[model samples]
Each structure stands twice: as structure tokens, then as C-alpha cells.
Target: MKNSFIFLFLLYSTILFSQKTTDYLLDKKEISQRELNSLSNFPIYKAYEFSDKGGVYNLVLGENQQKITKKDTLNTKIKAICAMNDHGGFLEKWSINDLLEAYEPKETNIWFWTKYCTLKDLDGDGYIEPIIVYGSKTEYGEVRRVKIITVYKNKKYVIRAVECDLDYCRSFKKDAAWNTLPQKVKTYVDQLVIKLRKEQNLLLKDG
Candidate 1:
């Protein structure tokens, strides 16, 4: 018990000091030229896809999308996620330099994904749970994190994050290994949080 308590204390202290990532803005002129280039053409990144799904609970779309009256905006966000299939996901964008730029380049290059996932009711009480699947490029590998951002009855949350990367590979390995206890076979999963990837005309399907 004492050992567990000490371990928890250490873990809490680490989280207490952790900081959200930041996304720096390049000069519009500098960015314009690079934006024109293809995925293979650009080296330094624009802060979105290049990041390995590291941010937690960021409201880049703002919480307004989840508002009942704001259904239009919510649809827009979903449409955008569905559109990632065209010409690769290199065009995924989140330029927050105008309002806030607290997003760090390395930490998450994203805002609003969670350090640890939590549950929420983005979908109404009775309905197929709605979700948002974000696609992007990461240093280690592809990163997809699902989220349900909705505010119901004054309760709002950022929930459901399933990431695909080397860092979280252990959690995935453990789960798969447990199921195949008798015969050990390496379970390789590089895409864990991806609801859809590289599927042409993906928008035609439900998110």
C-alpha cells in the first residue's frame, strides 16, 4: 500500500508540472509559399499533421459547435474531418495564431486531445454516439484521435481518444497479448485511433 501511494504521488506531481503544447505561426508570406508545395515538398511543418496526436482537450473549433443551436457549425467540423481523404491529409489545418497560440510544436501541435481520455455525452441521450476523427502526420507515425465535444445540460467535455503511435504501443500490446495468452504472436497496430484513413470519397460514409 505504501509503495502504491508513493507511486501515485510521483505520478500526480509529474502531471501537475506538465504544460500543454504550443503552435507557433509562420509569417503568412513564409507559410503561403510552403502551403503551395506538396506533402513531399515541405520540410518544416505547419503545426497540425506533423504533430503526433499529443494535445489534450483543446477547443480549436471552439465549444460553440456542440451547442444545439449551433448544429450548422458542428456539421461543418464533421464535413472537414470527412474531407481529409482527398489528396492525403496534408491539408488538415488549425491556425489559431489570431486568437490563441499556446499550442507548442512538439508537445502536441494540437489542442484538446487528452493526456488520458475521459467519457462525455457529445451525442444526445438516445442516438448513435457522434464522434470526430482527426487525421495527421506524426514524427513517429500516423496519429488519429477521436473526440466527442458537446455541451449538454451545462456539462461539456473532450472525450474518446484512441491514438496510434509508438508511445502508446505498449497499452495496445498488453491488451492484445492478454487475449492471446496461450500462443504469443506479436500484435502490430500502428493505427489505433483512426476511424478512417486514406479512403477516397470517405465523406460519402458516416463518421
Candidate 2:
């Protein structure tokens, strides 16, 4: 009887773990106005929604313009990626903002690389890590800068890179905490860096 009980307990544990693994897997979902209202406390002048997992994540992109002068306006962009439990209790919120120089003849553009932004339970912690990427570049795409931001638990890791064909300059910076992330997470970020480089026609490999 004791042996049977032990076997059944182990089997139940295994099944529970499997179910959790499946539940934490991320999937894309359509955005809804109700979800946007929940984030009204944020500075959401103009917003784009990327909600997912039955409202478990209220990821959104908020944008606004600040008028500096009659001929010049500064553009501000924000990303608010929030994680919540099944009961709608907030777990963590990752917010980032970027400001573009006042408008000029140079023509600057700033935007989130929405296709690269992803949510995953890379460590199987039953909570998803959000990876967000954005960039700003000149009108002709001569000089470009990209930023990759990812949050694990309440900690954030970032990578900043600049690519310029006009001056043949390429460089990148990693946050000091980057090395603290799990090997699997590091590998995932590296792969994304490679993809972003390729898309921009960068010749130098990521260091």
C-alpha cells in the first residue's frame, strides 16, 4: 500500500507540472477596448494594443507628441507591458520610453519592432518574460539605433546598438545584469540580435 501511494503521488506531480508548462506558453491575442481602459492611468495619448493570454498580459504601446515650437515637435513613445495572474492580480509592469529629437528637415522616425517583441516562460517559472524591441532612425535610414528590453521577474535587461553606414560605425552595449540571466535567456536574446542585424543589412556580427 505504501509503494502504491508513492507511485500515485509522483504521477500526480508529473501531471501537474506538465499542465503548468502548457499553461504558461505564450500566444498572441487580439486587443480590446476594455483592456485599454484598464491602462488609462498611463499616458495613452495614442495607443496600440498587443494584449495576449486571455488578458494575462496587457501589453500596449502608447505614443504622444510634445510641441516644442511652431515648426518643431518632439515625439515620445512608451511601451507598457504588464503581466497578471489568472485572477487579474498584477505581477509586474515593464515600462520604457523613448524621445525623438524635435522635428526638423532631417525626418526622424521612432517605433516599436512589434514583430520581435515576444512573451515566453523561458525558465518555466509559470510567469512569462516579456522581450520588447524598438528603434529610431533617420528618414533615409542612414543612421539607426535599436534597443532590446526584457524583463524576468522584476528585473530588466537591456541591449542598445547603433548602426551607421554613413560613417561605417557599429556598436552595442549590454546591461551589467545581462550576465545574470539564465543561459537559455541569453541565447534567445543573441538570436534576436542576429535577426535584427540581418534585417538592417549590418555586416558586423554581434559581439
Candidate 3:
């Protein structure tokens, strides 16, 4: 009995020490420029195909698309994840400087998307003060619901994103090591959050 017990313990330990393997495979999907230009709150499958389009392809449509209702808006808060960052993503490369400039309608690019969020001023403030997130599933990966908050500042609605899925965050890792387990897979959630907050605060202050 003692010998059998020792063998079982060693076996169990070996299994425990073994490295974990992931099933996540690199999805080769292409994104298009036209799709990117017309992107809203509709989920796209095979986002890798449209990756060139950039930004999350997932969108929230229908009544949810019209305007973020009050109930859903309240649930948009990050809740206990403040240490990391807010879910609404960040602005694109070109838009960063534009956002810093004075808020204006022409300056607002509805197509602009960031890991932090898609912003809009529903009430039509020169500034995109409202934060919102799109909640839905995409063809290539999981999709998150949209969070819309209407901040009553300057007698207009400011749109901003409050939440989005961390799983959707991904980037291309070129190194051979990144292709294997443990090294390649990392959540852009934290980085996205930081970037989003930094931009969010900046936009808010200016708006």
C-alpha cells in the first residue's frame, strides 16, 4: 500500500508540473477599408479578414443601436476593475491629436475606434463627451455589449465607452517563441485600459 501511494503521488506531481497548452489558433481573417469606414454596432465574423479595417468589428444594432438606454448605461461601469482600466478603448493613431483640439462636429470621426471605446456626443456638443461600448459577438471572436453614458455637461450628451471584452484584445506576435504556450498569449486589457483612461481624461477635460 505504501509503495502504491508513493507512485500515485509522483504521477500526480508530474501532471501538475506539466505545462498547460492552449487551443487558441491564429485566425487568418482579412478586414476591409470600406467596412472600416462604415463600421457601427454590427458584429462581424472573421474579423481577421477585415483586420486591415482596424478597430473592433462588433456593433450593437436595433433599439440598442439608436441610443444607449438608461438601464444598460448604468451597468456599463467597470466595477472592481478600476485598478486595471476602463473597458472603453482608445482613439486611433491620427485622431489622438484631433481629440486634443477643440471639440467640433467635423472633427468627430464616428468611424474612429480604440480598445477603450467609440465616442459620440449624441446631444451634439462640439466635444465627444459621451462614452459608450458596443456589446455583441463577432464572427472571428467573442463580442461585448455596448455601454453608453450620457453626461449632462454643457447641455449636451457626451458619448463614451464604459466596458468592452478583454478577450477581444489581441496583437500579432512575430517571434517564434510567442507562437508557443505562455509567451504569445497576453491580454491587452490592462494596456488598453491605461491608454483609454489617458485619452478619456484628456477628452473629458477638454469637452
Candidate 4:
């Protein structure tokens, strides 16, 4: 009977330890020369600093540009986002590559919507969730594609949308796993999408 009680106590303690929460804070930081050198492989354009129970973390966003030599001069753009620990070891990375094509009237443009990128513990989880938003546009900017990528617990949730005008999105897609997220996290992301659509003037009929 005493052993059974001890077993129960230990199990309870283990559950509490596994669910322990850490406070995380994120702030934009100037990239030092040393940090730049460390990330020399990436064309880093922006960076942020954050810390939790584990240690400090650096998050960076950049693009890899390569010239496309065809009939017309173009470029292949690869947007890269990464997070590294204090030891300079990469923790997570996300990337998307797209080819710049001449669309007769206008060329395709792809970029990160840095203003909406954020790091937060929306679900009150010990881990910080990194939310990244980016977009691509062609057809003389008449058609736009927006994407939001959020990483929680090393798992990614994605939301993709095609913007029509300035009122609603023409179409939107959410990963199946998105529906399984905490309600608060889902709400926060939904608000972010609304703000992005309104601020960017990318509204569709039934967005």
C-alpha cells in the first residue's frame, strides 16, 4: 500500500514537471557583426532576440536571390527563416522558393510581411510559437497570395489565402492540424489574418 502511494506521488510529480511553463519574451535586436558572420550563409535582413527557460534564441529572416538567365532577366527568390539557440545551433528553419516570371504587365513579387511576424506563447504553453507571414503577387498586383506559417512544439500550422480585393479573401486554406490547436491560439491567428487582409487591402468577396 505504501509503495502504491509512492508510485502515485511520483506520477503526479512527473506530470507537473512535464507541463511546466516557461515565460518567453521577444524583442527586435540589432545584428552585430559577429552574429552576421555566423549567419553569413543566409542573406539575413532582419533578426529578433528571445529567451526562455532554455536560453537565448535568435530568429532571422532573409532571402536568397539568384539571377535567372532566360530570354528576359529575372530572379529566383528563396525566402528563409530560421531560429537558433544560444549555442548557435539551428533549432528550426522554414523556407519557400519561387521563380520570378514576367507576367506581361508586371513581374511576380514575393516577400515576407515582416510587420506581422511574431513570437508568442499564445496557448500559454512553455514553448514560444513563431508566426511568419509572407505573400506573392502577380497579374499586375490584381491577384495576391498570402501565407501564414506558425510553429508550435516543432510542429507547423499553415494558413494560405488568395486575396481578391480589400474586403475579403477569394479563397483560404487551413491545415487539418490547425483545427486541433488551442482555441486561444486559433483565435489569435484568425485576428492576425484579418488584420493582414485589412491593412494590406487584400480583400475578397467572402473572406
The most accurate candidate by TM-score is 2
Question: Which runs of model 3 end up more than 4 angstroms from their true locations?
Answer: 1-48, 51-64, 67-184, 202-207
| Candidate 1 whole-model C-alpha lDDT, 0 to 1 | 0.28
Give the per-residue lDDT digits (tens) of candidate 3, residues 86-178: 164423221111111122211111222324443333222222322333233222322222222222221212233312323333221222332
**Model 2 residue 201 CA deviation in Å:** 1.2
lDDT string for model 2 (87-171, tens) is 5544545567676644322537566667777777776655566787877656564536688888877578999776654343566
Candidate 2 colliding pairs, count: 0
Query: What RMSD, rounded to one decimal, does every model reach?
Result: 19.4, 5.9, 19.9, 7.0
Backbone clashes counted, model 1:
12
Rank by TM-score (best first): 2, 4, 1, 3
Full-model lDDT, candidate 2 = 0.61
Q: Write the per-residue lDDT of candidate 1 for residues 1-207, one digit (tens) a residue.
A: 999999999998776544323333344454444442233222222212111123222122212132234322211122211002234334333221111122222222222323212222222232111123232223333343333332222222223333433443212212322332112111111122232334311221122
User: Which ranges of candidate 2 are over 4 A from the true structure?
Assistant: 1-4, 20-30, 40-55, 65-75, 83-92, 101-107, 166-170, 203-207
> lDDT order of candidates, best first?
4, 2, 1, 3
The deviation in Å at residue 52 for candidate 4 is: 2.1
- The lDDT of each candidate is 0.28, 0.61, 0.27, 0.63
